[model samples]
Target: MAEMILTRELFRHMCEEQEKLDTHIYRTRETKAPSLKSLDIAYTNEANEAIKELQKDWKWWTLKERNRERFIKEVADCFHFVASMANQTRTVGYCYAAIDHEYQKVSRISRECYPHEDIFYKAVKGTVQESIASLIAISEALGATTDEIMTAFEDSLKKNYGRMATGY
Candidate 1:
């Protein structure tokens, strides 16, 4: 058999392993019956399990600090949930493009605040709702119209999110 290239598929496989680890962690901690069997529900269950494990460990900081594997697994769980959710919703293809569009908007704002790295990072890390507000702020600062920025954002997303099946 041909060797599989180390690409998104590899990352996804890692994500799957992390998800299983998350499930084990959850089962060890919780006794509640799982209520959902849909892919979406499964994703939520796994994500919640990771969160619960992290929270439990967090109450004992020393335990979390000592368990590096657990820390890494938690991060992987978050990414796995996101990627799985995006795939299920058929939104994964557009993510890279959407992110790039967001980056440009962030970059423009960063340029205006040159030398203020904190401001730049804050702009880049804003929530989706906050991003809309940030764009408005950027427009006011750059004297461009909000409509233009939004149009660009929408166009980039549409171009990037074109449907493409990413079979794991």
Candidate 2:
């Protein structure tokens, strides 16, 4: 008699286990919001908080575990909000596209314009604001409320953080 291998079934089982782990991790950190509006508020606030922290020099210090943890948590929080909002808004893909537009503008300006600090800041800020507004409109078009759109934005940020952390 020959021994039989079940490699395909084994791979499926492993994938299922990994999914469960992902769900467990998500559930452990997620906070419940009764309405989509609340989720959006949470997303915007959390993103703001993360930006503040990122601006701090202490945030970049490797010795500060608390700061690192806080950064990670804030990003994760933003992610949750975004996911909820995207699902509600149906504008997830469009929002990402808008972000790309802003990034491209920034890059173009960075290369064409001389290294002027104030001008760079103005350009980047203006572009980001425009992108956000356009994304908001897109989200609304998808039948999403303001809150949902904000949440989706946060979720996009979180996904980006994950990629950075993993060096992907």
Give me the candidate number with maximum TM-score. 2
Question: Which 10-residue window of candidate 2 scores lowest in summed lDDT?
Answer: 1-10
lDDT per residue (tens digit) for residues 1-168 in model 1: 111111234334433543453354356556433332453454444334433433432344444432333323432333444444444445644543453455455545534663233332333345432232232233334343434433343342333233211211
lDDT of 2 by residue, 35-144 (tens): 67675566567655543433433234444333433443454444455445544455556544554454444433333542333232332244333323322322222244
TM-score of each: 0.29, 0.37
Which parts of model 2 are misplaced by more than 4 Å? 1-34, 57-69, 106-168
Best by lDDT: 2
Misplaced by over 4 Å in model 1 are: 1-37, 56-66, 96-168
Model 1 Cα RMSD, Å? 16.5
